[model samples]
Target: MQKKLVLGTAVAAVLAAGTFGAVSANASAPAAAPAAVVKADAGSDNLFRTNHLTIDAATDAAEAVLDAAEKENQRVSVAVVDRNGNTLVTLRGDGAGPQSYESAVKKAFTAVSWNAP
Candidate 1:
């Protein structure tokens, strides 16, 4: 189970890196015609759009992690954090160690800080 967890984490990290790399590569390309442009609200010029997971999406992500761990008979804690490293959702699975909760939050924060999985 531990091996599987480690392998899965590694795979996810690799995939995330690849995805970010692709995005960066495309960013340098010449801009194409806009598909659709929505005018921003007045006085919004100082603010740039940013994407973050919704509450329900974050909860679903945490639940998915818990479910995967449970399938491996592993007690674990799952946490989802926003781009700013704020906790969005946390789940301490049955029989999870007390320390697991904090650890999960820290891990989630680190992932967010690095913009990696």
Candidate 2:
């Protein structure tokens, strides 16, 4: 019985030592370096990048509409949106109702959706 107990203890100690050695080796191992990121140049052929409207152009369009409305003596709100339904400019004329703002936004979104002028 004494011999068997000694043999079992020796086996357990060997297994524990092996586990500790493996953990220590892993802890000392150097980590791999991160991959470098590549930047795209202006001449690069990137399919993800496409034409987009500039804020200046959108504001000009909204101003043109406001000019027309002013000439007609109309108190209204104007909203210019992009292809993605993002409002680039929103203008409310003098004495324009609060609901006119929401109406103008909806109109701009609808025009973008339908590709209307």
Candidate 3:
């Protein structure tokens, strides 16, 4: 009974030591990758860029351009777009009809895409 108790204690001590050693080793291991570590940006869908446009600015520019059209009594849609072919803002004159908004945006996108005046 004494020998068995001693042997059991030795086995338990060995297991406890091994567990402590393993925990100490793991604690001293090198840290994992940092939270702020930057990785290579993949694919073409980059989210870092922005195109700015204002309703006021686009409205002013477009109004000036469309003034002549309106003066000539033409019911045409005018579109305005930013430098990246994105629609900024649009204005449809009185009697310009329902599809005017679509036409204006399309024209603006086309103009900006092709870099037209």
Candidate 4:
């Protein structure tokens, strides 16, 4: 019958289209670009910028520590250190002398080297 033939043709078209669609979908997508590998140059100890301060900044820190100690009525020596073990500033109270300076520097250096306060 004509109806059967038409139905057969319609079914065939649909099956053909489905097959095409499935094949296209399963096809591999374009390969992604390779990931970049950043290599660090040797002999450069700087992971980032260096940390250094001027004398004024160091003096200011000492002054602040001295003022805070005065307000708290505590006699102690204080030393501020850079990110490195280098001493930035140092302040000693009336009772603290040469020994206090050495002690404060040692404490600051220890803190810097250990990465702890």
**Model 2: what TM-score?**
0.57
Q: Per-residue alpha-carbon lDDT of model 1 for 4-65, expressed as tens digits?
A: 32333332222222110111110110122111223456688765543444555555555556
Writing each residue's lDDT as its tens digit, candidate 2 over 12-108 gives 2111111101111101101121112334676768724334444554454455555555665666666656557787667776766777777777766
The Cα RMSD in angstroms, rounded to one decimal, for candidate 3 relative to the true structure is 34.5
Task: For candidate 4, write residues 1-117 as lDDT tens digits.
Answer: 323322222222111111101111111111131112333555677534322444454454455455555565545566656556566556666765456566666755665566552
Best by TM-score: 1
lDDT of 3 by residue, 21-69 (tens): 1111101101221112233466657635332434554454445444544
Off by over 4 Å in 3: 1-54
Q: Model 1 — which ten-residue stretch has the worst lDDT?
A: 20-29
- Which pairs of residues collide in candidate 3? none
> Candidate 3, 114: how far from true, in Å?
2.1
Write the candidate numbers in order of decreasing TM-score: 1, 2, 4, 3
Clashing pairs in 4: none
Measured over all alpha carbons after superposition, the RMSD of each candidate to the real structure, in angstroms, is 12.7, 33.3, 34.5, 34.3
Using lDDT as the measure, name the better of candidate 1 and candidate 2.
Answer: 1
- The TM-score values for the models, in the order shown, are 0.60, 0.57, 0.47, 0.51
Cα displacement (angstroms), candidate 4, residue 5, comes to: 85
Q: What lDDT would each prediction earn against the true structure?
A: 0.49, 0.46, 0.40, 0.43
